[model samples]
Target: MATTTNSTVVANTSAPTQYPFLGLPYDIFHELCLYLAPKELLVLYRTNKTLYNLLKSADGKTGVDGKHLWKRVWQNSPDSAFPPCPPWMTEPQFVALCYDDYCQRCLRPNLLGAGQIWTARVRYCPECIKTQFTPRNPLEDFPKGPYLNEFINEPHLCVPITPLRVALGDRELVRDHFHTPDVARLCRAIIDASAGAGGATDLNEKRSSVMQQWRSQMTQCHEHAKLCHIWQKQRARRIRKQRLLAKRYRRENILSRVNALGYKQDVSCLGHRYQALQGPILAVFDKIDALTDDVIAPQVIAFFDERRTLREWYWHRLIIGVRLGYLTKALDEYRQAAPDELLPHPVDIATDPMLRPLFTLPMSANVPYPIFQGLLPEWIQTWRKRRDDLLLSMLTDDAPSLWSCMDSKSHKSHSSRSVTRSSASHPEGPAAIFQHFYCTSCENLISSAAATTHTCCYTFVENWRAEAWHAPKTDGKFPTTTSDILDSACAREFQGITGWSSSCLRPCAAVISDILITLGLNTKFNWSDVGKIEGMHLRCASCCADKTLLVMGWRRAVVHAFQEHQGVHLCWVSVPPAVSYKAQLVEHARHKLTKEETAKRTSWKCHHCRLPRAMDAYTKSRMDIHMRFTHCIFHPQQGRDYYAAPEGVQFLHPTILIAATELRSENLDAVFPEGEMFRNEKRVGFLSRVYVTNMS
Candidate 1:
């Protein structure tokens, strides 16, 4: 019937077939279909009619029964998520149940697993169940008489009440619920309509037997619902544990690689972060034809070591290049004025005033700079190409397989040969056919191969993991403060000083080690080891039960208490600060500079001017004023001087005022200090005429 429906659907469309894979020969087409998992096959089946007709045709072009093909395909699928198919269900129905979580009636994933109500064979969530079912009270349904009421409430009828099954003419199921009178009348009509089918001579016996069967069926269904509920919980828990174990294993493997290479634990190398680098590195590995770990480990270590200074140069070059290449008006002018063959050299970037500070040649003319400069143009062109490739691969999901490390011969030909010999005895491969499902809540494209969780349930677990850093929402609004969170019942019950739920109280090391794993922070560290989570309040393990102290020194008292009296052990509870510690450190440094020592007494004479001895070797504030007036320059300020020097002398500090003065001198082709003295030179000539008689 499905095949016929598919054929009719294709025949109705005037447009040509758009299905890509149906062009293959029947043997090849069937072989390709065998590679898809049950879930993927279901997607393939629903995609279009041509493929559907091909898959569903009786004893297909290859002379294989379609039903048997489906069974074999399901049997070969590597995902063991499905249970044994019930005796009443076919392979197609079982595949449908395994693949998706959307409720049959509501068309939403409200109930994770489709808990099919047994007698009706319809799956629904709790809310949908309530909406679809009409309660049937025996007393209310039948006529109002003592005999009828007694019969309705009889000991034989004492089973748990089930919802009325609404079957219309021709056995068509009706999903909508109706009021008592309409429902009771319809149910009575159906029961009475079926009385003749039993063919009993007496009316009571037939009615009694029918009621008995109805009660028995309802009781079995109610028991089955209970069992299904329990089974779903157990399955969900088992799958969750397996997922956590797999995640932990993957995390450990990445960490071990990082440790082996003695690499720093930066945001790029930590949990889930390595995904960004995975494709690029794998491509490189394939190009070199080397093992992934062996090539990648050394390459990363060498790259970081060589690029330490080179990276800084690249950043500088990038800034200079972009500013000169695009942002500057000079580039546009050059483009307009210059001939086609005579392009501007990159060395001309020094001419732009806005770029001069960064483009100074002599200051940064190291070995790395020249190398970085040579590579800059090409690198800039392709900087975003790899990232774009990864994005496209993720979207298309036809990414090149990373499983090429296995025996190459086996991967391509083993399955084909096995299928040709006997499709039934074909073995599954190490790699499973997986499809990516996007989770909107967590923004993770989860692969079905990596986990067995429903995308909906997995999202909640991800949200729970994030609760360590992120304050959870209550009634759609997130609490803005720690105090607001503490007002909740869970927080109030916590014995720790932070007063947060126990779920948030993970070991600081574990949380800080993952760094971006939980909160997905963009922070990067330069350290070579897993750094401690600093700027947090620590609770002493020994003293916390009796008293809480904010300082680590209180451990002495805990030790004394333990030795002298009883009960104590060394454990610590590290609490994250509400305010940023980095901000606090900056503020503290600023305060110390401003309050204690902003003006320092100095012997560094202003090189821009020749001042009187008493006025020279002045305080930092006076020198700044002297420079501002004499040279039109602002002097660089510093803290208090350690030692005093003679008046009108200098200590060699690289003063910005002096460098500017020197640069001005070089540009003007004249000497400074003398330039200031040249101003005094004219005054002294006039003073000699007034104060002394020149005999000559």
Candidate 2:
């Protein structure tokens, strides 16, 4: 039977082809089909006169062949991020072939640098030749802009690029006017006159000279901007290399340091090395010496003028640079311009009357200028001495104090901290009072570990270690205040807390420390606050009875209100004076009433529930203190050191986490895991692979 559909002949194979040309085993036909591209297969369909006659009669409804005509589209279309032809590019084959050549020849080697972060081995197809790509960018989308910022990076966040400031062309300095020597000389003259009281000449002549200098200088500045363009590109190239090398070498050096710190990055280990790179990213600009003697001097001169217009750009940017920040010889270098000759139109206007009236440098500079006009000299001398002391201290051969040294300790020694629960003197307290207490012996070890901390210790070993900080004193005009000593002590306390939290796997150190120093403490003590929290009117550790500070209730306002001000007044908020047009007249009329005048009454509410409550000011405050003492549910013991949601807080139950264990098992099976279900359900994970299950 002959069957035709539209313009195509349907091949209805009998047992095997009986005719001479069509005689082939079914397996052989399959093999031949495999060797043909889709287009070639279509061509094969038209080869025979019998087949063509059967297929060529109609082109109407047999659009399957028309679909087949798009054989090239099917063969060439890819679901890959990169393809033979990129849609961004009109020519696909050329781009694909070139990309393959680029990947094999150029980009792979370029990515090679410290720790293979710059380089990774690539799998390539020699025939097709293609580059590997990342999916961090969106494909087939409109350009990201406008309101798209919410979907992009944060405002001040930096990203890695070759740095455009380093890559611009010489023609970029359109506003620069200081390109020629003549223009520079004119700028210099204008800088000098504007810097001082204008050469004792007529004001109008000086003003004309100043404006002429500005225009000429602007031209040179614009021309010089082009010079910066070329140098900027070179500088940008330098910056790229510096960034790459610094990242590479720093990692190498850090790994070296970690190794010296007794760390070897095990291929099997996950975290510590990841954390090493998180330190202040060793600056990503060009090398420090790349600027050489010219870094501040010439760029400063070019950017600023005596009129402070161009110059203020440099000053303001320098301050922003300070905020972004680099180390400075002087701290005030950011906010104020220095008076060195490097600064535009260098002025020694100390003795001058007119100029001194308007401009003054910030106090960070200890240079007591007569332009400031009123300095006692001793205060300036004291500041200079302190600056010298700070510089000398930086250069001092100081081994890190004991707390700093403790940072590199073995993980086990730090992890086994004991939580000591003590009986409360008051019965009204939580069922348990817990403190992360150290053995006296362990504390003794900490004291002997560092001189700075030992100086504050009064123990036997510390009595000897205390000698390291003492110096023979001569009679002086003043004695250091105890307040200053307390301030220093407070900084060390925070430093200790910082060291303990991160390395000890305590992430929520701030909040935990707040509880320890405030409501849960044995005594009212901060290195700064020597006073007591256990007041009669205050909600404190000493007052709460069976309060049972649980992490669950701590988030509730009813519970947390107890920690604020005892039970008296829940909070005391300052109110601004009332604005009423008739308040003055009302006050006068009230005064006219004399002895029977009444005091103004104000309404108050409960801080915890926002419910209306009534009390006099004194009684209100007392009630607030009592409430905090009785109900503050936050505990010192709830440190964040685990992965699971803090036991009782059920705020978020995301779908991803719902029945996670079952999903995990399904995922393992999808990966073709070879295992049987254990009788003990807890023994289900890869982490628990070898553990025997106790089936009852």
Candidate 3:
């Protein structure tokens, strides 16, 4: 065991010593040391005893002998304009004060550099600065005597004063502050020196001499501090310029590589010009390294591809919005021309299978209005037929007896006609009686046209900007290449209809039929027939518990049944009073005007009521009685409570009307023609697919 221990010790001693770059000749080492900055040299000096001895002078401190090395390093530095060391301080001291980034008191390192009180020749952290400094206000701290006079006259000689910048409102104010400990030490020194004096004259002379020497040192310090402040500002500006150049260099290199990969157009489409692509570019904008192709190529490809995918998605939505806008305007004109016709909402038309493809055309396609105008008539016919079929199916499943009666009446009407029509054009059934449907989600009574467009079932794209569509992860990492963001946004903004179909609608028809039976009216009554019946108001029995006497039309009664009574059963009863005249009057006054009547009319006014001061005109569709509940004038007298003045009314100009009509009828060739319809070479590949999948 003793032999083995000796052998182990010898093996440990035999291990070779490693000296890295330090083994270089003194001349080479000195040249390398000159290349390092003052901060780097300071770091090297503290690394080991060998380097400290090599760089230090014979006096065992970095003194005059080593001053030349520091001077060469300073000359080679990026900011060579740094002021030379003053005669009172050594080169090492000046370099450490200017470049060392640690608090002198606490010794804590700050990479951003500790705050310097150049007048005091010290660096301090924020905590040390607050605790060590005292505001130099003579009236607050000193007696009203010679000491106060000395402070007011020669503050620098009495104590080292540093200016503290303070922000006051819009301006910056500088107040003199001093180190409390330094002030106390200086006062103690002055007092101790004066104690040995024989008389007042000698003591005054001694004090004057000490004050003069201190004042000279402080004056030099103030002048050097000013130079240092200017050097710091210039250095900061240069560093900022270098960083900005590095950022531009990296951005240009990445964009060039992306352009080579055939994404120049995509980048332009989603770049800062439109403010579309920000995340990936901003992620690398502040980077300082010269990014290599291998390191940045994959990230650039992933970022641009993902951004391109998002841009395509946005373009799809944009095209859909534009098409929907046109369709809405066209539908409004159609309704104005033919008020009796029942057309589906523009949104529903956009979602139709045959029409949806037209809306999903590539972004480059410039489809004219005439094409949609030509197809609108047939689309409307198909929509009405489908709506009738859906209602018929609903009645068959829920109210077979009502369906049978309507079918028989329809067959009889068909036989009465001399020409036999196809089943697609069969006579309309009693399904029109159930034109109004109830939304279970929102509990609102809506017409057939509005049922499919209800917010409860459909999602609207509110944010049109592409940049807002998706955001980077909070931790600053972006997804590599994935559709999770796009899918989530599409799920919110382009959802398929969830509960707008006939099967999903609340059983409003059954409730209306029950109400009809209660009122002793035929269940086969159409909307117009029901509207023609005078004094047809029904009161909610459930609401009567509050003694409110809530009477409403059949539509509102259906809504109340669902909202207040859960729509399982109705608690409605007909009013027994013979007040048909009064009921008719109330219905007329409360009835909302048609779109055709309210389009541009500006002379509507209520005779019974006027605006405050009677200065403003009232052009709202309903009478003024509708706006005030306390008025209780639902049965407003026509021409007395409400009248339409002929003079103030306006209509579309004849020339504008003729132009619009001609534009609609004008037969321009299809923009893309027959075979080229969906083959725009510049169109994004995934756009049509994404649109169809999300919108359909």
Better of 2 and 3 by TM-score: 3
- What local lDDT score does residue 500 receive in model 1, on the 0 to 100 scale? 9
Query: Candidate 1 has what TM-score?
Result: 0.28
Order the candidate numbers by lDDT, best to worst: 3, 1, 2
- Native-referenced Cα lDDT, model 2: 0.27
Better of 1 and 2 by TM-score: 1
Q: On residues 1-696, what C-alpha lDDT tens digit does candidate 1 reach at each position?
A: 232223323332443343355464444455566677777877877788765765676544434356645765666554344444454466566567645677777787854566555434456676677765664443455433333334464422423333444557768553434233323543584368445644433554555554556557556655555654554566678767776676556545544565676544332322243332344443432342223453345665554454334333333333443333332244334445543422222322232233344443433444344444454444323423432343334423322221112222222322222112222221122121123323333222234321221122211122322232221121111222232221121121211112101121111111121121111221233332113332222333333322222222111222222332232222333322421222233234345443433245444554432111211345656766766776667644443221232321111110110111223333432322322111112322111111100110
RMSD of each: 37.5, 41.7, 20.4
Query: In candidate 3, what are the lDDT values of residues 1-696, reduced to their tens digit?
Result: 121222222223333232355665444465567679887887887788766664555322212235556666677567856887787777678778877788999998877755877778888987788778877642334322333445455576656677777689999988877777767766665676677738766776666666666668788888888988888888888988998899778767777777888877675664343344456556764478887554554665777787677566655655655666677567767877887554566655665566667777778888777767777778788776766676555444444322222222222322222122233332243544455566676445555554533345444334323333443222221223324333222233333221124544664665766556555555445666665434465555555433223455555566666666766554456653432223333344323432444543445555543211121234554444353653577576657666664322111110000011122222312311221112113323221200000000
Off by over 4 Å in 2: 1-81, 86-253, 261-281, 284-619, 629-696
Quote model 3's TM-score: 0.60
Model 2: weakest 10-residue lDDT segment is 650-659
Model 3 scores worst on lDDT over the 10 consecutive residues at 652-661
TM-score of each: 0.28, 0.15, 0.60
What is the model-wide C-alpha lDDT for candidate 3? 0.54
